[model samples]
Target: MFGFILRRLLSGVVLLFVISTLAYMLLYVGGGNIARRILGQQATAETVAQKTTELGLDRPLLVQYIDWLSHAVTGDFGTSWFTGEMVSSGITSRLGVTLSIVIGATVITAIVAVIIGVWAAVRGGWVDKVVQGVSILGFAIPGFLIALGLVTLFALNLKWFKPTGYVPLTESATGWLATVTLPIIALAIGGIAGVAQQVRGSVVDALQRDYVRTLRSRGLSFNRVVFKHVLRNAGGPALAVLAVQFVGLLGGAVIVERIFAIPGLGQVAVTATSQGDIPMVMGLVVAIAAMVVIINLLIDLLQGWLNPKVRLA
Candidate 1:
């Protein structure tokens, strides 16, 4: 298990390196007149040149990347080109807001999906139909629309949650929950739809297997047979789906955060990209890539634990 975990971590690190390098190259090579944009249209040519040289944009792309990477490894992402804020500090301040929504959505997706999926697979009548219908609706509706609807119905009409603004958990736990609840729900709906379907299918397949019959013949109770044996076999695919959903939730949080007026990495990402703030953008790229790599590693570890065959593979 230790070896397996080490191997996964090594691969994750490699993936992070590759992603960060690609993002750096793409941003530097394709992003046009970053200095001019930062300096404004009225700036003189000599001024732009001075700004460019000051930013080390005049250096070779490879050299620039190496310099950035060297600083990045030491947790020194440098100051933003546009705002002059420390990239690390800026991102760190907003990271928690985005993570709260995404992680909360993921947890809700896993638990609710499992329950609904298992119920649909076991009952197999109106309950199954209703689950299927809801899954289809979930797939059809975009997350942003869900966010809008939730804001309107719950925040505006019912006065359940605040329409916009975030409260830090450190400030007040209940206030934070109230603020984030709608955004989390909006992000989680689609994830639940996708993962629930996967769970339902896997559970159904497990129920039809010969092992299920064997367990039944051995006089195991229905609940024990399903929960202990069937779910164990079916859990792998559901977990895989849930991991994918978690990544999607990260992307979805960008839009949801905007709608909810939450101060998060999403706002910074949009502003940085638009302004061609390479240092800030690169910081975000590295941070998001590292997160994805870590999430994938965790999923791989869970998969290996659930199915020893996965470790062999």
Candidate 2:
């Protein structure tokens, strides 16, 4: 297990490096005349040249990449070209807001998906059809649409929540919950729809296994047999699917954040991309990539631990 975890960690590090390098190169090569963008459209060629040299854009690409990587390794992501603020500090300040929404959505997704999925599998009637319809709806409608509808219905018409705002948890737990409630629902609904389908399929297959019949014949109650044995075995795959969905939720937060006007990494990402902030963009990319790799590694280890066949093999 230790060896497996070690290997996964090393592989994740390598993947993050590759991701960061590619992102950096793409932004460096394709972001197009950063000095001109920084200096505005009216700047002369001489000013642009001077600005480029000052910003080290005249340096060899490899040298620039190395310097950026070295700085990143020490947690100095460098100052933003446009804002003149440390990129690391900028991200740190907003990290909590993003994490709050994503984490809350993940927990909600897990609970709702399991309950609905397990019930749909065990019952196998209209419940199954309902679950299928939900999955289709979730896949058909984009997340932005969902966010818009939610804001219109709950925030605008119903006046149950604010249309757009963020309150720090440090300020007031109630205010924070109120602010995140709609966004959390917006993120969780689609995630739940997808993961619930996976769980339903896994549970259905688990119910067909021979041991399930054996357990039933041994006078075990239906709930006990399903929960203690079947769900445990089925959960490994479902858990993996859920983990992947969590990553998707992070990406979708970009759109949701915009719709709701919540200040988060998503807003920063959009602004940085529009302004051609290479260092800021690279920092966001590397940070997101690292999170994905780490989450996947944790899921792999969890599956291995749950299924001895996986770890032993």
Candidate 3:
């Protein structure tokens, strides 16, 4: 296990390097005449030259990339050229808001998906029919639509919860809860639908196995047999989907974050791009890409751990 974890960590570092390099290059291409724009076309030659040197836009691309990579490795994410704040600090400070929404949604997704999914699978009559219809409805409705509808129904029409905008966790816990509640519901709606569908399929297949027949023939109680013997094994496949959905949300659903106006990584990335804050945008892109690679590597490890055949092989 230690060796496996070590390998995953090493892979993560390689992925981070590749991601950062790619982001740097892409930003360079996208940021047309950046120094000129920042300093203005009407600015004096001296001003343009000085700003260019300061931004290292005058340096060779290779040299600039190396400098950026070195600073990233050293945890000195450097100052945002646009915002003039330390990149690491900027990202860190706003991370909590993202965390609250992601964590909340993940917990809800798991609880709701597993309970509803397994039930629908094991009891495949009206339970299956109802679950199918609901899950399809969930998949059909996009998150932004759901979020808007929720805001309209709950906030505007019903006046149950307030519309979106973050409230800090430290001062007003209840307010924070109210603010995130809508976004979480928005994010979770699709995930639950997908997980339930996957679980239903996986569980149905698991129940048809020869071992399940043996258990039934042996006179074990239906509940005990399904929950104890079948569900755990069936969970392996379903868990993979759940892990992915968790990562995607936790890393920040950019669209949903924007719609709800949650000040998370996604929102920052958007703002940085719109303002052409290259350093900040590159930092956020690297962070998000690294997050995805790390999560995928973890899912690989988890899959191996749970499946005995894979472990034995």
Candidate 4:
């Protein structure tokens, strides 16, 4: 198990390195007149040139990347080009807000998806049809639309949650939950739709397997046969699907965060990309890529634990 985890971590590091390198190269090459944009149109050509040199934009791209990577490995991502805020500090301040929403949504998606999926698979009648219909609708509706609908119903009409703004968990737990609940729901609907279908399919397949029949024939209770044996075999695929949904939730949080006015990496990412703030943009890219790598590694470990055959693979 230790060796399996070590291999997964090493692979994750490689993936992170590749993703960061590609993002850096693309941003550096495509970012046009970053200094001029920062300095404004009124700045003279000579002034812009001086600003560019000061930022080491005059350096070779390879040298610039090496410099950034050297400092990045030490947790020094440099200051934002426009705001002059430390990239690490800025990200640290906002990371929690985004993570809270995405993580909450993922947990809800997994639990609800499993219950609905298992129920549908076991019942196999109107219950299955309803689950399928809801999953389809969930896929058809956009996450932003869901956010708007949730905001209108819960925040505007019902007054259950605030329409916009965030409250830190450290400040008030109830306030924080109120602020994030709608966004989490909006993000989760789509994920639940997708994962529930996967779970339903996997569970149905497990039910049809010869092992399930054998277990029933051995006089095992129905609940025990289904929960202990069937779910164990079916879970591997559903977990894979859930891990993918978690990553999708991270991207979906961008639109949901905007709709709800929660301060998070979504805001930072949009602002930095538009302004050509390389330091901030690169910081975000690396941070998000690292998160994806870590999440994938954890999923791999979990899958290995659930099925020892995965470790061999």
Given candidate 1, what's the lDDT at residue 17?
Answer: 89
The digit string of per-residue lDDT tens for model 2 on 65-137 reads 9999999999999999999999999988987889899989999999999999999999999979988898779
Candidate 4 lDDT (Cα, 0 to 1): 0.92
Clashes of each: 0, 0, 0, 0
**How does each model score on TM-score?**
0.98, 0.97, 0.91, 0.98
Per-residue accuracy of model 1 over 230-310 as CA lDDT, tens digit each: 998899999888888888998898889889999999899888887888889889988988898888888888888789999
Better of 1 and 3 by TM-score: 1
Which ranges of candidate 2 are over 4 A from the true structure? none
Q: Cα deviation of 192 in candidate 2 (Å)?
A: 0.7
Model 4's TM-score against the true structure:
0.98
* Two-way TM-score contest, 2 vs 3, winner: 2
Give lDDT tens digits, candidate 3, residues 1-313: 6666677788888888887888789889778878787767799888888998888898889999998888887778788877689998888887777777777887788789888998898888998999999999998887778888888999889888877678898879898888989888888988899888888898899899999989999999988988887777777888789878877676446777887777887778778887788888877777666667766676767766767554344
Clashes of 4: 0
lDDT (Cα atoms) of all candidates against the true structure: 0.92, 0.91, 0.81, 0.92
What residue runs in model 4 are displaced by over 4 Å at the alpha carbon? none
Worst 10 residues of 4 by lDDT: 297-306
Deviation of model 1 at 129, angstroms: 2.1
